[model samples]
Each structure stands twice: as C-alpha cells, then as structure tokens.
Target: MVNGVLSPKETIWGLFSATFYTNVRANLYLTGSSSCLFLKSDHDDTYLADKEGTDYRYEKWFKNYSAIEASGMRCVKILDTYELTYSTRPDARVKGINMLRLPELYYIITEYYLSLENQDEAVKYFDKVLQSRGLTGYADRQGATLTLEKVIQERRKELICEGQYFFTQKRYNQSIYEPKSGKLYPASNDIYVFPLPENETEYRY
Candidate 1:
C-alpha cells in the first residue's frame, strides 16, 4: 500500500491524526488522568506516535513504593498498556480513546465515501467527522444520499458485537428479524442488553 501511494522509503508513520491525539490528550489532562502519559511527546507540535513503549513510567512506578505497595505500579502499568498501541512499522494502530469513543467509525466512513469518488459528499461527511469531536450522537444524515449497503458493511465491521449492531440495522430500516424464527421486531427507545450466559446462571447456586 505504501508503494502504491508513495515510494518504499516514504513510509507513513504516526498512526492517529493530530485532532484525535489532541482531543484525547486534552481529555486525559482535563480529567486529571495520566493514563496516556506513556505516549506523551517530549516536544510539542511534532509526532512521537512511532516511538517504542517507554518503560520510564514503570521504573518510576517501581521506585515510588515498596514491593507490598503495588497499587501505584498497577495504575502506571494500566497507562503503559493503554499507550502501547503502535507497532514497530506503524500501520494502523488503535487509539487510546477507542474504548469510550466511536470517532473512528465516522473517520473510516468518510474515507470510504471519498474512495467512491463522491468528492463533494465525501468532503461534507469528512468535515462532519472533523467537527464531531464536540458533537454528541450521530451526525445529521438528512438529505444525504449514501450507499446504504456499503455504509452498513462498514458499520458492521466497525461496531460488530460492540452492542450497536441492532440499533444500526434498525436505523437503516433494515430487517431485524430473528434468523431462525423469522420474526420482525420493532425498534425500542432504549438499547437492549443481552442476558448473561446460561453457564453463569447455572453456576450461581
């Protein structure tokens, strides 16, 4: 892919976008959280997303307390694990906010549309994703003529069993029928949380 786009020497590094990195970093700092301190850059306005996992935090964690006082080390280890999202070659690394954030879906969808050569609409949706760092919920899809099949495929790939699948299917007015039963269901105002496994219930006693 790098050869297709640029020369072999011109490898693209540093996974996340500036806006995404800035947003998550600001959120971490504002929340008084140091969970991302491992990925923190020594210099500003430049990227260090390609750097290796820094064990400095771990060293600090160990030095701060005795063997019995491991809570500090645990916290530091959590931060360290969270920031170690990059690979040595820097392809597509996961972002720190992936657990609590769904921004990547918007970014990927915008890229997919752009690949289809719908430049104007792609730019429109891409801009929406760019501006959506502050906006809540889904973007306004009113009057937008998108390819439902492709969008649904992307949504499936991104969301899967992350608990948004049914709602996304319903949003597109796609059939939500049970596969074996072939029963259609109405949309609910609230999301449906799946019940625990039978094994869990059986072991409760």
Candidate 2:
C-alpha cells in the first residue's frame, strides 16, 4: 500500500498524499471544513443516489464516524479525518498539503499518450493507477482497450474532492454530468467562463 495515498486512517491522505512528502504547517492553518457537503444523513436522497452510483473506490475513501440518529439515519462521513485530527490539536505539526500527486502524474502521462494515439503507452500508465487503487482486474477485463472517454471517467473517479474535475472537463470542453438530473449540461462559455465583476467592468466602459 502506498503510505498515504488513499488510506482514510492517515491524517494527510485525502485531497493530498504523504507518499511524496509531509505538510509540516497543516495543523497551524485553518483548513476549510467540507462537512456541509460530505457529512450527509443516510436519509438524504442525494447521498443515497451517490452511494448507489459512485465507484466502489470512491465509496472506500469515506467512513461513517457519527452515531445513528433517532430517525435511524446514520451520518455518512467523508473527508473529515484530517480536519478532525488537525482541529483538535492546533499545535501539532503535520504534513504539508500536496497539490499534485503521483497518481495524477500517471493520469497526465496517460492522457498525453492517448492524445498521440498510443493506446499501449496510455494503458500502461492508466493500469498503473488502477493497480495502485487495488483494481488490478479493471484493465484486464476491458481487454486493455483505452479511449478518451475512459480516461476522463478514470480521472473523475480518482480525483474526486480534489478540485480537479472542473478543469478536466474544461480542458476537454466536455459536457458536465449532473448526477441528480441524470443529464448532461452542454459545454459552453456560459457555464465555463466567469463573468467579469461589475466593479472591474464599470471603469473600462
């Protein structure tokens, strides 16, 4: 197992990896809490939908840390391991946040090869990521076939909660997949580009 790649028990695993190095100043800084988004009740329709539709590897990244409520709904905890740990002990030194990880590099290389129409080299790096994530049978089951769509889905599954998915979609100009609506939001500048602030535009006009 990679030391701090995806283990929920590791303080610095999710959204960042410790396999490369540690973030010594993490404890001192206030990391934003994503509890509003991730800490969901079992009764929540969105949570249930996600649990049913998301990849098994994505489900493995979370844990239920809260007690069952009177309504029989349990809290489906996700990505709070490090936040809970660091918040409790502000004085503790922890690993620094790693913006990029090796798996991401592997995905990048995979995409690069794919762009060149080199399916073999693309599969080579893509399989490396799958193997690391304990999905050794995935590539084999697909007969080692690779496509740009497959690569995009793999990146979505692997890089969830890391703020990379939007950029990936933008880079490819792909339509956004809305899970709740079960529809594709068409790719366009209206969705992709941010509007200039009113204050900034006023002076230029």
Candidate 3:
C-alpha cells in the first residue's frame, strides 16, 4: 500500500498473495526494507546516500548490476506470481492486490507531464520513482535527456506480461506488428475492446 507524501519515518508496504488449489502464499516486500528513505530534490544527496549500507541503503546496491537484477526479480515475483493467481475475491483481493501503487502513480504522472512537453516536471517525478526504488541507468538510457518514447519503453520493460500492458496497449490503440512475418494487426476496431456482458445488460441484480 502507498502512503501519501511519505515522511522520513514512514514506510510503504506491498502485499502479494497467490492462491493455489490447496495452498496460498502471501508475500510482503516493503520498499526500502528496514530503511527509511527521505525523498529529496537533489539527486546526489538523498537519504540513500546519507545512510549508505545503513538505514536507507542496502549493501547489495554496491554490486555493479544489482539494481537491475533486483528490479527484474521484484517485477517477476510480484506481478507474475500474485497478479496471475486467484485475486478475484471482493475484500480479500481488494486488500491483497493494488495495481496502482505509488511508483506506478508516479510513472503515470510522469507520462502526463511528458505528454504536455513539460520535461522538467516529468524528469523530476520519474527520477523520484527511480530513486525511491534505487534503480539507476534507466534515467540515462539514451543520453542525459529524457524522452516520452524512453519513458514508454522503460514502463513497458518494467510492466511486461503484467495486467497493465494490455490496457496501455488499448489506450494507445497500439498495432500488433509481427516483425518476423512483417504483418501489422490493427487494434483500432471493436476487436481490442470487449463487448459488455449480456447478463449485466439483460438483468439488474
């Protein structure tokens, strides 16, 4: 769950639950682990740097490619294991699953600013997310400058195979182009959007 305007001592906890035929597992991965990250505007001097290998920093961050690897693992573990499983209950699933967490909200906000050509604000928010997650190299993938395409591409990479990608695809009305076969399947028609269920229209419960 996301806490609004995280304080220096506050925390954001993520709950992931997967149910099987005879088994269920609920995992909790709190952002920053035991550390309390204070979000700051200056990129270089944040709580992470201040508490390196201590409250706000993890020793694993010292590895050359640990951030990327850890992000990949978290993405797979949370989205794949939990989201793809039985998360269909009303209150149970509602408390268990949150598709739009803080980082996601930040990403959406960044996307909005990027659409408005507000590069400064977009970069600020996007960097906030990256810094919060202790992820590097993403902000400077192409160069010093950030672009809408880069943001889209990074988001796609982060959320691939999750439930969000399909909706994003629909929002952009993205074409399903087959590179190997050189075929483009358009998604502008009714094929992409599902029709309303007959039960809902036919009767009111």
Local distance difference test, each candidate:
0.37, 0.52, 0.45
The model with the greatest TM-score is 2
Runs with alpha carbons beyond 4 Å of true place in candidate 3: 1-76, 79-96, 137-143, 176-185, 196-205
Instruction: Provide the RMSD of all predictions against the true structure, rounded to 1 decimal.
Output: 18.9, 8.4, 13.1
- Supply candidate 3's per-residue lDDT for 117: 88
Error of 1 at 98 (Å): 6.6
TM-scores for all candidates: the values are: 0.26, 0.56, 0.46
| Counted clashes in each candidate structure | 0, 6, 0
- Best of the two (2, 3) by lDDT: 2
Candidate 1: where are CA atoms >4 Å away?
1-100, 103-146, 177-205
Query: CA shift at 21, candidate 2, in angstroms?
Result: 19
lDDT of model 3 at position 77: 24
The global Cα lDDT (0 to 1) of model 1 is 0.37
| Model 2: lowest-lDDT 10 consecutive positions | 69-78
Clash count for candidate 3 is 0
